[model samples]
Target: MYQVYYTRDKAGRITQKLETIEGITHSIDYSYDLAGRLIEVKQDGTVTETYQYDANGNRLNNAQYSKCTTK
Candidate 1:
């Protein structure tokens, strides 16, 4: 399980996030344009993912990955 906390700026722009689970912690940072368009998202001390959008606010691209392994 994972829990997340969100922090926003006065403009209501989400600037940071903290995620924790099972004693491990991960942080995420966000940046938005003046138009409030999300331009970037960074996690776990790395720029592991990115997002892009079209003029109509439709998601054009997103890059991320996840996997589960059991031994």
Candidate 2:
């Protein structure tokens, strides 16, 4: 299981996140434009993905991937 702690600004905008489990910690940071639109998402000290949106707040594009591992 994973747990995340989120930090928000005065306007209740999520600015950062911290994930921790079994004594290991990871961080995610968020960036926004002047219009309060989410522009980027960075995780574990890396720029993992980015997001783009239309003027109507509809998601235009998102960069993401997934992988699986087996023991």
Query: lDDT of each model, Cα atoms only?
Result: 0.80, 0.82
What lDDT is reached at residue 65 by model 1? Answer: 46
Q: Candidate 2, residues 1-71: lDDT per residue as tens digits? A: 67889999877999899998887898989988777888888877677778888988877998863433499
lDDT of 2: 0.82
User: Largest lDDT belongs to which candidate?
Assistant: 2
Highest TM-score against the true fold, candidate: 2
lDDT of 1 at 35: 74
lDDT accuracy of residue 64 in candidate 2: 63
- In model 2, the worst 10-residue window by lDDT is 60-69
Give all candidate RMSDs, comma-separated: 3.8, 3.5
**Model 1, 1-71: lDDT tens per residue?**
78889999999888899989987888899988767877778777667567788878877998774433499
Backbone clashes in model 1, listed as residue pairs: none
